[model samples]
Target: MNKTLIVATLALTLGTTAADAKTRLLVNCFWPSSHFACSEVLPAWIDEVERVTEGRVTGIIPPKSVAPPPDQVAAVQKGIADVSVMFNGFFGESVTGPLVAMQPFVGSNSAEAMSRALWRTNREFFADEIDTVQLLSQFVISPAELYSQTDTPMNSIEDLAGRKMWVLPGPLAEIAKKLGSGVVSSPAVSSNEIISRGVVDGHLGLDPQAVQAFQLMPYTKSTTAFSTPIYSTSFSVFANSDKWAELSPEDQEAIMSVSGEALAAAFGARWDKAAAAAVAAYPEAGIEVVEADPAFEAALTEAAAFVTEGWLKAAADAGMDGQGVLDFYTSQLAQ
Candidate 1:
């Protein structure tokens, strides 16, 4: 063959190779499509991924979640979905590093700050805690406040003890149980069913945005805010290890440029904004909001001591300095 003919053939082969090298990720969102995470956060991150990688890497959210919230990490591990978010609470002892952020009365109300701090702390310590998937980023939602549908606000441990409460599974549930509150523990997605059905007289595991998103506003008569968050849920944005490994080193680096702390900041900012809107609408919705008196706050602090102790023990068992890690996370929040 002539030189021109040989060159033309090589060009076509290279073009086909480039096309075959492109990757398309199947992203799953457990929340409703109308939710900010599905509608905005994931999509925005996908856009950045594509842009940074020059269209070599792209992702799309499926019409529905591939698995329930608690099973998200497993689904990704089994390759049922290429990427998804998992709530840290669902894994129990399987995931301990993130529990630092979930400790009662520890985190700030600002999801952005808390999220960034969690990511940084995770990277520096306990990085091996989650080895099943490629951990991409981390975030914490706004801190949960006490919301009651009962005759009176839950201002003290006695008030809380008097009512059966629905709480987000994990630390919050444990805290309520310790406080002598009759507890029904489940994922936040189930909050509507339990609250609307009056399965519990109060709830203790949702930020204002979640309260609004889960449609619990109608069922909640009063909200008692503490000096610090009663509790917060931590989450991990992760990808299937196999799928992540398939990407070229250059593309992987490109994607990382827009992930980690950048992604956490984006997700946290959305939570903060949505929560603010929800809180501002409280008056119009007729949901009475009251700040917890110092006595009430002190009572809760005393009751929640065990949660912190348990976490510190777990961290030590995992060969981590639990108190040091916790101190680092809280110090980052103050900054």
Candidate 2:
């Protein structure tokens, strides 16, 4: 008998059923159980995997996430969990490739398009950077808009001078510094407390849905909506390489067929809807959403050059064609 069959016989002798012989994948979800990723995306993906594989593969969520957000990639790579999704920037300098998606004003306003573009770009140009884990998909969320807690909206570059704003580390902080704004570096979880206590005058890098999610909407007086998004976060759904190798070739193909760009599009579309709904409800919460005027656009155009150049320099350090990636991304979004 073949070694594979022999192993199966041995496993059956150990009192495991035939159904138990199927490969089981454990998805370590970092978001809260109530979060959309946990409540919807994972479940739907699991269903599709099962259906496509004819029950040869199945997936389950753990009682809780195995690791925090920043540790998710390592957790999956080391096999602490078989699968997980994580934001690109949360890992800091260790991650590469997804940086292209995080750039300001490069993506389509349509999250679905941006998400698909990210997947395609990563596959074409940066797969080596993320080969530690098996990538199932890549995606970008809806772009974030700037919000101010005060009644006076920030409309121009001059308006940002000396104004304190909470910014997550990355391009946003760099942009804030370039504009001569005081930067208050804080994680998203702590933003509510910091902003509520007036520790900062406003914040950048969150969409309307996030503002509501973080309870910033109640405190926000006006939102400065840029024609292009100020920035978007990149995310990946991935699996442990060792775990992936254990699956049958057919099962692997089945799982992959339903993942990647397909899953990315789903995530992007859902996020876009949530952001739109949140923006629609802003007036009921007594917050004004202001579109950026020509002057403000001119200033943003000038300010973005610095952050973009910095990203390109960093990309070059990583031995990547930063400009090529950016150009490709723009063309993809334009489509």
Candidate 3:
């Protein structure tokens, strides 16, 4: 071969090798495209991953969720998608440590603060709990509140007992059941069906943003606010373990730099802004808000005490000092 021909061949080979080296992640968003988790949070994180890796690491979210919310973890594990988020509630016995964030009356009203605190708590205590995937970050939405669609407000245990309620599954559902409310439990995404049809007289598990996102405002007449939130939903962002292992060490480190607590904070901040906007629109929406009476708050707390007790037992069975971890998480939120 001529010298010029040989040089050109070498250049072509190098370009092909570099192209093959790039890793493009398939990130799946289970929420609707307009939802912040899909529209903003996941996209922003993907942008940062691409930026920090200098184009070596990049990701694209599918136009629609690759699987239903409950099936997300399994889909990722099977390599159907490279990345996704799952609600911890759906995992049931498979997940325990993260339930600390879900304990009734434990989490803060600020999603950002609760998210960052959950991440720190996970690192300090529950690091080994989630071993199925490459854990990226953990986040909690703003606390869930009790909303009544009837003429009566959920001011006391008796009011709650009289109404049939739709509740977000898991701890909130369990709490409602224990309170003797006629409970219809399902995923938050499906709340519209039951509420719009008047299948339930009240709802027990949605933040302000969720009220707007899920279109629950029209059916909701009033919300009884507690001194602390009744519960919050916890979620995990993760990558398929095999796909994660395929990345170079440098690229992996770059991704982590933009994830972990940083990603949690970003998600939480978006939630706070959206919740604030929804709450600000309440008056025009004709939604009434009333603070829980002090006596009523204490009574509700007493009724919901079993949720924490159940979690503590599960945590202890898993060899975790459940109360210690809970105390640590709450202390972080206080800061």
Candidate 4:
């Protein structure tokens, strides 16, 4: 009986050793297979990582794989998967500097400005939050717009009051609350269920491609262009801490070369392309597009200042000098 047990142990050890010898990377995505970024951004990244590493690394994004967006960061930290996106709202009550970029009227063109700011954050303030895993890159989603069930235009906050609107966490929900809407936060995966069942009168959480990806048009009759980017979700690529540690310095450098800010540049370019497709499809979806009056846009700017002050308070409590980071970030953006 002792001899037989020893043989079984040997066989199990050999099998485990063999599996560890092979290089593997498993990526989780927050969108379905149809999303341009999931299809294009992920595959190209896997190929580049493999090419740069000379086949020392390989990856796959299984179809319908990622569970939900907000849960993805925790999944990576627990080593459930190699890498995926994370929502900024989950960073507790404080840590709101990152949330400032999401405030309405922060910037109309976030692709460039926000992406650079993220690169800076990763190099500086975010190390502790992301210490569990190796951070590859941080980037934001496209600008969010209001999608309504009727042609009642959200031209002003007064227009948004006394109505129901769907909003996710972070500054978007805060904006919705200030506007007097009953806020509803839904996972991207479950957006269809809530929107279809009248869980919300309208949704303020989607970018353009979201209209088709979530099949939102069935519940949407109109869309209002935000005065500026209302909110942009943050995403980061992460590898399990143990897996990252096992790699050599050369391999680590290679990973950063192919991932992180390099990949972030690719992310911005891809969003530019996807945004065009989303804009083109709005007509076919029979959704009316409306632009807010200039006066209304100015009022939103004032509300944004109020929210900005709150973010400063939150950031200070987090032990980060809010004014310093914000000032540096905006300066780099200007230069």
Candidate 5:
């Protein structure tokens, strides 16, 4: 073969190899495409990943294709998808300790603090607690506060008590009970059907965008919070262990770089921003705003103790040092 023929062949081979070397990952998440968690965070994450990978990795997220957000983890675990985002709270009856995010006053307003602690805990504690699959990172939801309709103000435990209140199952209701409020397990209902029907007076949730997405806040008249927030929600990004193993070392490292605490904080900030936007919309939306009365706040803290006890017990059952996990989480936040 002549020099020209050899050079031509080499160029073609190199071009093909460059393109083939690119790694492609399909990510699945439960949030609707419009939701910031999905639209902003995930899309921004893909961009960051691509930029950091220097074109060696690319991602695809079929916005609406992932189905119910609650089932995202199952889809990934079943190999229906390669990666997914899931909530420990959503795991339902199984009782994974990290879902403790559902309990009030357990988290702070700093997403970075919560994320790093959660990531660390996953390696040391959650690893044994959750054996179903692999965890990339854990993140906290924005904030959990009380949002009520205009007719009534949640001024004190007495104001909240004797009133029909909406609470998510698992850990959140300990506060409502302490406040002497009737617990109603229907956030979805409050977000849609129940609020419109006047079944409950208030809803507890964070991520202002979440309320907007569900359109539940439109019916709410007021929100009660410390401004710094009492607690935050938590969730994680994950991959199917089997599929994760199939990737090359370079690919794994590239993905891992995007995991851990930093990502958690970044995700957390987005929630804060979203929540702030929702809070600002209160007056325009005909929603009222009130500080949680001291009595009610005190009662809330007292009731939350039970949730901690329950979590510690559950963690012990799962072979973890609940106090250690709690200490790590709380200490990391202070740092």
Candidate 6:
């Protein structure tokens, strides 16, 4: 072959090698495309992962979620997708650690504090329960609150009698039932339809941004805010363990450097901003937001105690120091 032909062949091989060197990961986002989780956090994290790895690895989210919110964990674990974000409570008895964050009144107003605390708590106590997947990060979104379409604000326990309240799964629902509220349950994605169609009188456990996202403001007449949130939803970004193992150790290290608590903090901070913006726009949307009265608060405190006691009992049965873990998480928030 001529010298020019040899040079051209070498260039073609080099180009092919360069293309094969890039690792592209597909993220099966559970949140809607319009949600900040999909719209902001996921993309930002993807960019960070690629940048930190010096372009060795990159991630892409589909224009729409490949799996429903509750099914994401299963989808990723079964290798139907390489990555996913899952809500721990949605899996029922299958996973346990995220319950620490889901515990009523256990979270702070500061999403960053709650998220980082949950990350630390998971590291210390919940790893075994979550060992099925490679955890990229853990987060507690906004603290939970109630929004009602009612004649008057929900100011006391008496006001809850027989009123329909949409409750998320787990302790929050249990608490609502114990308080004499008629519980209607549905996922956050369907909240707008549920309320708009008068399927339920109100929802019990969504953050302000979620409420706004679902366009719940028009149907919701009153929002009862607690001194501390009623509950928080725990979310985790994870990858299929097999897929995660395929990455080079250096790439894994580079990706993780931008994950864990730092990733959680960034997600939490964005959630806070979204919640604040949603809450700020409430009046313009004609929704009445009110603080829970002291009497109502006392009742909530009693209900929280009941729920926490149940959780602690369950934790002890699992050979974990439930109160100790809770105390440590709360302490971390103070710092």
- Ranking the candidates on TM-score from highest down gives 3, 1, 2, 6, 5, 4
**Please, what are the lDDT tens digits per residue for candidate 3 over residues 1-335?**
99999999999999999876778999999988878899899999999999999998889999999999889989999999999999887776867988899898898899999999999999999987888899999998878888999877889888988889999877778777888999998777889999989999999888989898888899988999888888888899999999999988988998999999999899889989998999998888888999999888898888889989989999999999999999999999999
CA lDDT scores, all candidates in order: 0.89, 0.84, 0.90, 0.72, 0.71, 0.84
**Which has the better TM-score: candidate 4, or candidate 6?**
6
Candidates, ranked, lDDT: 3, 1, 2, 6, 4, 5
Instruction: Name the better of 3 and 5 by TM-score.
Output: 3
Q: Candidate 3's error at 194, in angstroms? A: 1.6
Report the C-alpha lDDT of model 5 over 1-335, residue by residue, as the tens digit.
99999999999999999767866678886766666776788777778778777777777887575657678778888888777887767776564667655455777766656777777766666665555766777888766667776577776667767678777655666666666787777544245776667788777654456677678766877777663466677887887888778766776787678766667777887877876787678778887767777777776677567777877888788777878888877777777
Residue 41 lDDT (model 1): 95
Candidate 3 vs candidate 4, lDDT winner? 3
Cα lDDT tens digits, model 2, 1-335, are 99999998998777656555788888988877877878887889999999999988899998789998889988988888899999988757656678898887776577889999998888777876877888899899888888888889988887777589998777788889888999998777778888888988888987767888888877888988777887888998999998899888888898989998999998898888888888888999988988898788777867887777878888888898989888887878878
Provide the global lDDT of candidate 1 against the true structure: 0.89
The TM-score of candidate 6 is 0.91
* Candidate 6 deviant stretches above 4 angstroms: 1-20
Per-residue lDDT tens digits of candidate 6, residues 1-335?
A: 99999999999999999767977888877776877888898889999999998998898889987877778888888988888888877767656566878777777898989999989988888766777789889998988787778767787887775688888766778888888888877777776777888877877888888888878888888888888888888788899899899889999999989999989999999999999999899889888878889788888778768878877887888788888889888888888
| lDDT assessment of candidate 5 | 0.71
**Higher-TM-score candidate of 1 and 2:** 1
Quote the lDDT for 197 in model 6. Answer: 85
Which stretches in model 1 have alpha-carbon errors above 4 Å? 1-7
Deviating ranges (above 4 Å) for candidate 4: 1-22, 64-68, 93-97, 110-113, 124-129, 197-200, 332-335
Residue range 182-236, candidate 4, lDDT tens digits: 8887666677888889877888777877767677877788887755666666666
For model 3 the TM-score comes to 0.95
RMSD (Å) of each candidate, 1 decimal: 1.7, 3.8, 1.8, 5.9, 3.2, 2.8
| Candidate 2 segments exceeding 4 Å error | 1-20
What does the lDDT read for residue 51 in candidate 2?
96
Error of 5 at 197 (Å): 2.3
Model 5, runs deviating above 4 Å: 1-15, 92-97, 127-131, 174-180, 187-190, 227-231
